[model samples]
Target: MGIELAWTHGVYVLFVLGIILMMVLRRDTSLISIIGIAFLGLTATGSVIASVGGIFGSFIYAITELLPTILVICIIVAMSHVLTDTGVNETMIRPMTHLIRNATLAYWVIGIVMMVISWFFWPSPAVALIGAVMLPVAIRAGLPAIGVAVSMNLFGHGIALSGDYVIQGAPSLTAKAAGIPVNDVIAASIPLVIVMGVVTTVVAFWYLRKDMKNGMIAPASHNPVTSSVFSSAKVPLAPGIKRTLAALVPILFVLDVVAMFVFDLRGGEATALVGGTALLILIAATMLAHKQKGLEQVTTHLIQGFQFGFKVFGPVIPIAAFFYMGDSGFNTVLGEVLPQGSHGIVNDLGVALAHTIPLSKEVAALTLTAVGVITGLDGSGFSGITLAGSLAQLFATALGSGVATLTALGQIAAIWVGGGTLVPWALIPAAAICGVDPFELARRNLYPVVIGLLVTTIFAMFLL
Candidate 1:
C-alpha cells in the first residue's frame, strides 16, 4: 500500500529547508524559526491567534525540554569558578604540565587532560580551565596557539562532549528524543566516540607536527589569562592542599562514574549526582577561600552561574523548539491542530523519504549522519541533537537497523561538527584564551574532524 501525504509534511519540509538555508548563509535562524513556528501554527490550527500563541508555546516547550542540560552545565561552570578562587583549579593541571616538557608532549598532554576534565565539567568549564592554565605551557613546549585550541576543542568539545561518558548530557538529549533510556545511548556511543576521538586527535597531532616542520605556524602570543596565572597568588598555601583537592576531585568523580555503572543511573539521575556533588564541592571551596565571606561568595557564584547558563541556552531554546515539533508527540504540547497521526514534523518527512528513496542501510546510516552534520551547522552542537535523535528512531525503524547505534552515530556527527571544531563562534572561547583567531582554529580542526566523522559514520553502519 502507498502511504498518504499531508500539507503539514510540506510545511515541515519547507521549515527544514529554511533552517538549512539560514545555516548555510551563516544567518541566525531565530527570526526565521519564530516565523516558521507561526506559520506552522497557522496551518495546524488555521487561526492567527493560535499561531501567535504557538510561538510562546514552542519556546516554553523547548526550554522545559532542555532545562536539565542547561542547569547541569551552569552548576558545573559555577563549581569550576569556585575552584578557581582557591587557585585549586591551576593545581589540577600543574602535574600535567610536568609531563609536557615539550610541544610534542604538550599536544597530547593538554588534549588528554582536557578530555578528562570535559567529561565531568562539560567543555565550557574545561576550556576555560585548560585555556587559562595549560595554553602557555603548551606554547612554551613548542605547540602553536592554534594547535592548543584544536587540541582543546577536539578533545573537550568533540570527543568528550560527543561521548559525554561522565555527564551524559549529550546522550541524555539524544536518548530522550529517541524514546530510549539514556544509559543505552551512553553505552552505545562509547565505541563511536572512541573511534572518532582516536582518529581525529591522531590526525590533528600529525597536522600540528607537519605545520611546525614546515614553519607554517605563527608565533605564539600569550593572552591575559596566561599572564595572570604566571603573575601572582595572594594566599601562600602549600602544594599539599592543591594536590589533595586535585586527588580528591578525581576520586569523587571516579566514584560517581563507578556508582553510575553500579547503580545504573540514567542521564537525569547521573546528572543530578554529578551536579549535587559539584555544588557541595563548590560550597566547600568557597568556604575555604573566603572563610567569613563564603556565604556571599557562594550566592554570587550561583547568580553568575545562572547568568552564563541562560546565556548559553537562550539561543538554543527557540531552535530546539522549532525542531522538537519534528517529533510527532510535541505537536500536541505545542497545540495540536494538525490531523491525526501527525508523527511529529521531522518524522513525517523521514517516513516520506523512506517510502520514496529506497535507502539501503549504508545510505540510511550516512543520511542520518549527514542530517546530523547539517543540524550541527547551526553552530550549537546541541541544538540539533534532538532532531538527529528523532530521525535516528525514524531511520532505524525504516531501515531495520538498531536505533541506539544510529542515534549514537548521529549524536557523534552533530557534536564533532558543531560541538566547536567546525564552528568558528563555538571555537572562540578556546581560541581567544589561547590568543588565536577562532576562524584559524576552526580551519585547523576542519580536516581531521571531517575525516573522523566520515570514518565514524561508516563504522556506525556495521553496528547498525
Candidate 2:
C-alpha cells in the first residue's frame, strides 16, 4: 500500500524548514516556529474545536510527561544551591587548587571537576559552582577565561550532560522515543560518551596550547568575588580531612560503578545513590556552616537552586511539547486524533523517506547523527533528541540496527552542537560568565567538537 502525505505533515515540514531558515539567518528561538507549526498541524487536521482541544491536550501531556524530569532537576539544583550557600562547594574546590597551580593543570582540573559534578547534578548547577569559585583560581593560574569556558563546555555540557547517567533525563527522553529501557540507553551510551569526551578534550587541549604559544590568551587578573568575598576565609588545609572527602567522593562513585556492575543497578538506582549522597553532603555542609542557622541557609539555597533550574528548563517545555506531538505515544496527550493503526507523523515521514532512500544500518546511523547535528543548530540540545529518537526507532527497524545505539549516537551529536559547540548563541551564557566573546568561543569549539563527533559516530557504527 502507498501512503499519502497529509496536509498536517506538509505543515510540519514547512514549519521545520522555517525554523531552520530562522536559525541560519536570524539565530532566533525555535519556539516561535514550533508554535506556528503546531497551530498549523491542528488546523490542517481538524475543526476549530479540535484545534483548541489539541492545544490544551498538548499542554497537559507535555507538563505531565516532563514534570518528573523537571522536578528532579529542580531538586538536584536546589540541593546544589544549598551546598554552595553552605560553603561546601567552596570547600570542595579549595583542595583542588593545589592540583591546579598553573594554566595547563587548571584546564584539566576544571574540566574533570565540571564533568564529574555535571554527571550527577547536571551542567547548569555545575557551571555556577565551578565558575563562581574555580574560575578565578584558574584565571590566576594563567588560564584564560575562554579556556575555562571551553573546558566547561566540553566536559560539563558536551560530555556529562550528553551522557546524563545520574538523573537519566537525557536517556529517559531518548529511551521513551525508542521504546527501550532507560537503563539500556545508559549502558549503551557509556562507550560513546567516553569516545566523544576523549576526542573533544584532546582537541580542546591542542587549541589551548596553540593559543598559549601565540600569546593570544592570558590568565584573568581581576575578580570581583575574590576581592570581596572569598579572600577573607583562612586557606583550608590541603589534602587534609576535606581532601579525604574530595577523594572519597570519587572513590564512592567508583564503588557505585562496581556495584552497578555486580548488582546490576540501572541508571535510576545509580541516580538515587548519587542523589542520596548529595543530600547527605548538603546536610553535613549546613551543619558545618552554622548549627542554628542551618535550616534557614538550606532553604535559601534550595530557593536559588529552583530559580536556576527554572531558568534553564523553562524555555524547553513549550518546545518539547510541540515535538512530543510528533510522537504517536505522546500525541494522545497532545490532543492528536489519528485513525486507528496510523503511525506517528515523524515515524511515517521516516518510513516514507527510508523506502525511497534505500538506507543501510550504517547509513541510517550516520544520517540520524547528521540530522541531530542539523537540528542542534537551533541551540536547544534537548529539542533535537526527540526527533532523532523517533527516527532511530524507524531506521533501527528498517535497517536492522539496535535502537539504543542509534539513539545514543543521535543524542550525543545533538547535544554537542546545540549544547554549546556549533551554536554561538547557546554558548553565550558560558562565554559571558567567563567574560569572553561568544562568537570566539563558538569558533574555538567548532573544529574540536565536530571532529570528535565524526570520529565518535564512525566508532559507534563499527562497534555498536
What tens-digit string does per-residue lDDT give for candidate 1 at 1-464? 22365676677669878875776565776788788778878777778888898888878876776676566656666776665556676676567567688887888888899888778666765665466456656765667778888888899888988898876788999999999999888889989989999999999899988988897886564543233344444444457876777677656766766776688664467667777777877787777767788799899888877786676556556666676665532565555655566445544444455446556778877877776776665456776688778878887877665889988888988888777788655565576556565556777887899899889888988887
Clashing residue pairs in all predictions, respectively, total: 6, 0
Query: TM-score for model 1?
Result: 0.66
Best by lDDT: 1
Across 249-275, the per-residue lDDT of candidate 2 in tens digits comes to: 445545655665577554345545544
- Candidates' lDDT values, in order? 0.72, 0.67
The local lDDT score (0 to 100) that residue 37 gets in candidate 1 is 78
Give the lowest summed-lDDT range of ten residues in model 1.
223-232
Q: RMSD of model 1, in Å?
A: 6.6
